[model samples]
Target: MPHPERNPFVFSDARFRKFIGSVAAIGAAALVLVGCSPSTDQGGTFADDGCTSVVVATSSEKVNLMEDLGAAFKDSAEHKGLEKCATVHAVNVASGKAAQYLSDSTTEWALGADTAPSVWSPASTVWTNRVASIAGDKVVAGAESFAKTPVVFGMPESMAKALGYPGKPISLKQIHDLIANPDGWGAAGKSMWGSFKIAKTNPNSSTTGMSMLLMQAYAASGKAQDLTVADVKAAEEFSRVFESGAIHYGDTTGKVLQNLADRTSGKGSSYVSAIALEETSLYNYNIGNPDSHTVQPGETLTPPDEKLVAVYPSEGSMWSDNPAVVLDAKWVTPEQKTASAAFVKFLHTKKAQELLPKYGFRPTDDSVDVSKYLNADVGVDPKQPAVTLPQPEPEVVSAAIDQWAAIRKPSAILQLIDISGSMDESIGDGRTRLDGAIEGSTATLGQIRPTDEIGVWAFTTGLSSNIDGTRVNGIGVVRPFGVLGGDKEGLQSDIEDLANSQRAGTPLYDSISSAYDYMKTHAEAGRINAIVVLSDGEDTDSATRLDTLIQKINADQKEGGNDKPVRIFAIAYSKAADVESLEKLARASGGQVFDATDPAKITETFQSVMNNF
Candidate 1:
């Protein structure tokens, strides 16, 4: 039990500096994997007359800053007479993306935003430490705070008044209590001393959003003043409010920010505000439409706080660690590696550091005046400075996220698998699509317990169970669309049994619709509900057809599943597989699609289904 150095692909290698020096492309690739990708075609690999280019891998937010930052480095690249240059292809590589990238050995460096790569950007110190831990004992890497602002509780002025505005720092205890005992808040609707709402991400993604939940868990459980599993379960009290079945799946920082402007979303709700939100988002929100319907105000708990104040959870909060490292892949050159290092150094220079104000970033240099950037820049009040956070061992934290997942809420799921023709093709290593499907299905089953429910439906010869159709037999029955039934144990048996009895052809369409039908029938809000569909090929057999089911799924994602508008995630198996169709199905259900042959990646696919449910 010392923290395993295995680095769960999401993040690997405790030592930061040396790793980058070893692989230039690794970092850049990590960015891509995490959904923080920068576009290419800006510059080519090797420039004329010995100039070379290396990939700067990192998250989109950091990648967004690359244009200006990268360009500035371009000037230095020319000035230093260095033959190589660095171009950032902002791969959307987040922590989860990092694991994939490292496993595959792509990209140059893994650049992140917070000091601690795992959580939100509490302050410069927190970001620095996590990256250091990620870099481990040897690498001498330092976090350069380019810009920063405190995370403010963006509540209406009225809500602030209800919570005792302008009082000492908001007590985390109050927030935890609200989540732990939402019923209490209901009785005291006018409760003013301290008002709070739950802020969370799906835990599978959104490091910062997860941070908010963890802090609360620690406070609620009170197992230790320092962060621990006990504290996390206690903080899970926030999920209690969700048990009412209110929280939506996969609402990250961006969505939460949008919800903040809408006051009607009563009681426990709000995002930790940042300075550099999407420029166009704020512009549009402030502009309002012709009817000005969006430009309405509600009884604010605290009138929109003018100056930014990052409320460090009184019990303590977590920080985000965004590190800029180089992957140093075979494609990289020594010149490119040096350029990457110089680029990082440039970010700390006066010109780049000055950007902290306008961009809503807090400067790492203490000497600079953060206040000057207040209104003129992002309107982030200069009063706040970067906060320092404790760096808990990564292993303990990983376990915390799991415990958080458990105590939060139970999930209900329906597996809508496509039994089409292409499942017949041989994947690499002599495995068929169905073989992989069975592997994934088997793995998914082992993870589920009684609290979780799963159902199975195999489509090929007919809509009934793949085996002999026995009414309510241990195996689930297939219907018109792709739907299944029963608890975890029951569902697992059905899926495994269905795998055993699958015919040569895959009935993709029928499977999808049937699975969807189950969700509609059993639709319950508190239960995390979804239907994960997999098709090795196209929909050959389906009385209803895949197109019709897709349209219905699309309509549902935009509008919440009233009874159970199931979120659908899909896995496109094999090389010739119809990824487009699979992707379309997933998007309709607010899920994403995956290519089965590529690295046999089920991380995103499996994660999407589990997290959404």
Candidate 2:
């Protein structure tokens, strides 16, 4: 690049040097443009040519792979001797979230599993073509198979045997029969009851959720005959079977995997449900197995009896191929795009794809077999790559997901705030525990719909426990305070007010106990009632012991009582914050215990709870 001091006319004419120079400047600019027109190098760096970085937005599940894949192309210990190639960033997200972020100009590349991601690869061509119709710009079909594995119906082997697995093949109808066994309907169609249950991933978050919905639709419409919409709608038994089984249905496939893992962990109960989930996640445990044998990396064994039976489902089965997507519109550059492509390529490479097997996911590469990466005892049998995968129209698929979302049960949430003195201490963002509690509670309310009644309760003062004759639980007071009628602005305001004006007390027992009673008394029948309590201190004030509260809550729930037996969640603000208490309370009510010492991260914890709900 060069800057000219004077134009040709300015140097030749002394009279009108300024004017001549201005005129000459135009001439010089035209000459420079002509010279730079693909003839000469007019730019300083080739990076300016727009081939640097490429942003690929993707499902959050792929974020790990994306980062790992990106690192491999750099030639350090992880990527030794490799060129400074394009970077790959996987924009992982919740199930439909990628689709929503894709239309925005910020994310030029969208990655995801199934119809959500527009980039074509694996079995994504059809999805890409369809999204392009509405998304406008056409996407390039990149070459590579990052991970390929069949989606299977996870269940205990004993349960599978009862469903005609050992001898006769179990059809979709049979699976339905097993789930609806305790619940039967002649008009809906039932050959026999296998006495098993059924569950599914949340249609809102997991890719398996998408797969499950489409499968149900196909099965309902009689995919055996390439079911039509009319056929699906006319089949009254369809909704019946789908809704009957929900033993461990979760917001994400990972959550479902944890549910399965937790059940058969040690002397644990097993779910006999025909839960639809990805084989990949089934073997990847956040916590290792009983023996070093199955816990070894790249090792996992099937139970002495293979509880998991792959049911292609008499109808079409769909696979989830999540893609990477970028959302920062202003920041998505060519460099990021290149990085994304490189990342995809790296993932498809032999070394990386091999990691899929340990997680029970089969790789797409032909050079290597999954058995090497799997502990045969606990691994899924994904042979011949899902020989028959049917692709239904996206509209049909979307409609099925929509229907599932609608039919799902509503959530009754209770926010149990710890208003003890310890909450007065400031936790990040310059906000005290009380302030954090209020902020988190109010924000959580904003995320939920009004149909979802979120109630807030605080535990403090002499009402902390069941002392003497009081019905309260521990001193860690957590109860309902603010309640909004469904989703509304006024309701939001009321929740905010409750958060601000909450009375400080050390009697956590009173709040949690009363809130449970309130929910039990007021909750709409059939909703999943749950209470979430956050505390920064211990229970020094509860008059009632934890045992009494648990006993009462359980008894009341078993037999209808005022508290109606609600799920109680315990969230400790820190490690010193009485983990034992939270765990006991949470276990009693089937609620989870979360350690949330930082109020700034309260939103994340709240969101996690919301997802599970």
Candidate 3:
């Protein structure tokens, strides 16, 4: 049941009160499978065929859990009541991607299932509510939450202790105070910890990150709920300050959690000190599933040596009621709907509900004790998270998402493009490797804010190289660094020219080292400094050693004490590209490595890398 007191602010608002009253009336009735029907009664009678298969589309975070539940359904005897063997097929789709599929049923990825999905279980009800608002009665008309978890700061136990956590609830205001201080955690006697690197998903792409944004809005307004457009506007400065501490913004929290788990010590080696995550993820981490990837059948989890503790903010936080919605799409048959309902019922069963605690989730069934799973050993307090922030209307969430890019930390990025002879090869789409790289990269420039400092570099071995008196191994720079405000067109022209240039051997090593040196020499304060390199070939003609270049890059990063370290993002362009070396370069600078091996994904992959800003 939705907490009435915790959500009072949303209910009390005049607009929301009216909206909820009308929506609740629709939700109270079980809608039919046929799309856009005025009647809310979903009751249907169908002859049991003795066997039915239902496809369930789930969010990435719950993929493993859903798989386990699916296996359980297949082996359960309680399902005999339907006189049908219900085959539950679970597909893991990211929340934002699933939202898109719901909007456009013709989406290519959704077609992978033998039949259309009968149910859609995103990580949070926020998504269920979103689909309802967009598609109206034609989409998810009703949903049942199976498990409950709240958003919390997942940090190493030692760091939490230093910040007075567990003993005291850490507030966002306290976090902001630390971010504002240049000394970072060093002000609190932990100088080696360096800057307070926080990790969060891009709000537009993630449920957990979206909840974090709401928390920030409430913190700025000093309210537990009813976040307004005015509140979002007022919170812009605070949001920027808070966002400045983010080392990287991924599409999901798994990457951040995995990075934290990789280094058990949770010191300078770890990319992030704290990450915004659902308690389920922290639970999974403590149990040794760092990546939280899909789990195969009969697999047993091996707990990790390092544990991540949840720090519920004193200001307030949001609870994710992981709702499973039986989608009211045209493809859902009466038999399938009945099967889906059975599966939902099975999830609430005592046996199935008992599995929730073992996976670090609070079961929705009242019979299961929340205390059994919520304990300090796994890094959560059974009695805490006393406050649940009220959710604003969906429109308010949309507004906050739109405002993020404007208030996010500015970036100083240098994109290094490789124009080797191999780039002239075809990618089978009537587009050459160079052409795809140019077109894809040019499109990404538009997403960069005008205030950001940007530049373009195209490197090939024998092209009036910039090795004059500089380093003995400097590769040619097609275009130098320029501010995007006035040089956007010029940079685009340079990118296009790369496609038309006469190809030469790739100077991968020298070009990378030279670009790194250029950015390091011109590193700007108060902005994220980064280098994005797209290469389709290995070093064919370069005097620089890969190890030596990596050493210089790592050494230069250490020179700037607490100055935002310059990160390198590498895109391994094709099958023949050297991914292992690129991964090394990216990891050396605390950045990410993106794969664009499929020619078709070049544009999308480049855009994904831009999300880091």
Candidate 4:
């Protein structure tokens, strides 16, 4: 039932031959799980019933599908034959985060499921390979493809037509050239479309971003496979050119797609010309479900007026062979392993494979037809991805990530912290809301390169002047913008001083408007120019109205044809925080808002926001 010809994991390189061989052995075993009655246990532990409890930690995109399959498998004769031996739980975990958790022994696996996973199925084997390289071979012994989707450039239908898509394949080199050209879409004779902007996620945190990085490096080396460390080094300049076109980076692609969908609804020009996404993601976007979350029954789906079509690179692209990997960890019991294998076998059945296409995924079992779902109606081609770039050695993949860090666009960030009276309220563990925020902000400094430009501002009503004797306003410049390499210590000190600087009343509107204007005036080219706002309450003192501030942000975003748009990334720090206003401000400026209502999670939320830079 397996389609060898359609399989993209076939490796010709000697380095990965053994790995591929092991994968085949695993696949042949049909190792998976079968569902049973739901457990009424806490902390991801199995109820002390006679059945084995198998936990499958999967990437977020496949959680619903896996859950459905598990539910269906519960009633099968195969499960009944085993006397309901196993109860399976599918939990959502980001691929990159899962790899990080497995790599670090001390890190607790508190990702939704409180217990460590018996099996880990990330989006691609790339993650499994990374885990193996860092945590040792014993961590991820082997993995097999469960479903497949190729990385692609999701572009508006009109834009794809202009680039000769469908009629001709678009190569990565062509995309790089377009990104480097100051003329933007003018090179394609569509000046009205404006500059060529792209939305790319942080490679360290996203599978699509990792695939994009690898493919771009391979394209630069002029090789279809067998990429080397030298090739990645040689492609630094090329990578920089392509990265320069990015409007911003995030931990996930959902934000990018959601932004595009929002623009479509508003009947405005798309925020970005293209976004790096999986083929399934493009299909979902075409159908107006850009976030690709499982649509609930009775939910009305509205297709976007402007659909996004997939452009498989002629130079060759990569596939996310959603590999189901049974972890070889001490935590996994033999019984759980057996149940895991059974679950994977159930996934390969015709019934299970048939459901994959309905969700915009290609079945790993080639016998399952995909033509019905992957068609022009959904902005995808069933026969696509004729050529897949070979998987490089794990070392090469690691080196590419390092090279990306060096060549990726730097950021210019101005952080605004609310020092209102409410910030003094205790969150828990003897820490105030301000204390948690400061901790998160301080930690964020280490996440960015020293070459980045950084500054800080503290705001509260009646704040007339700063430590630097700056002019009067509702806010004070705790630290002026400077190269982070030189001002790291001073910035840290300024942030610490904020704990003692709490004052009465929040001047939210005035602070954001002033910060926005300042950032726009000093916006740097070849970097992410933006403001980061962390607030714990609504505006209590400000001359500027919310509507007036939004209008100013909109006007600035549209100015100079948006050549240097300054984005505003806001974090609502507590339930009392004004989330709706923050969302509007962030959306207007081409940035996204983060919800941190639970102050205890501020540290995690802050790091996520920093990934944008």
Off by over 4 Å in 3: 1-53, 77-84, 104-118, 263-265, 268-270, 296-306, 328-338, 370-374, 465-479, 486-490, 556-560
Candidate 1 lDDT over residue span 97-208, tens digit each: 4543333332333232211111112122333334445644223244344443343333333444445544555555664455445343443375332223333455545455
Local accuracy by lDDT, each model: 0.44, 0.48, 0.73, 0.78
lDDT (Cα) of model 1: 0.44
Q: Pick the candidate with the highest lDDT.
A: 4
Cα lDDT tens digits, model 3, 351-405, are 7786566556788886777554457766878666889897798888887888887
TM-score of 2: 0.67
Model 3 residue 61 distance off true place after TM-score fit, in angstroms: 2.4
lDDT of 2 by residue, 467-537 (tens): 22556543332333334454466545655564444344466665566666766666654455777777777
**CA RMSD for every model?**
12.2, 17.8, 11.6, 9.0
Per-residue accuracy of model 4 over 1-613 as CA lDDT, tens digit each: 1111111211123523332233223213322222123322113454444566667787656755666666656655446556346656666567887888888862455543345678788899999888888889877886878799999998887788889977989988888988888888899998776788888889898999888999999899999988999999998898898889888898888877877777624323437888899998887666556676544433444566677888999888899988887787767778777777777767777777876875678998898888766787677888888788988898888888888788888899999999989999999999999999999999878767889888888899878664334475888778887788866777778898888884789889989988887888788878899899999988889889999998888777665447778999999999999999998889888899987988888987898899899
**What root-mean-square deviation over C-alphas does model 3 reach?**
11.6
Please provide the root mean square deviation of candidate 4 (C-alpha atoms, Å).
9.0
Clash number by candidate, in order: 112, 68, 1, 9
- Candidate 3: residue pairs that collide: 30-42
Worst 10 residues of 4 by lDDT: 1-10
TM-score of each: 0.62, 0.67, 0.83, 0.88
Cα lDDT over the full model 2 = 0.48
lDDT of prediction 4: 0.78
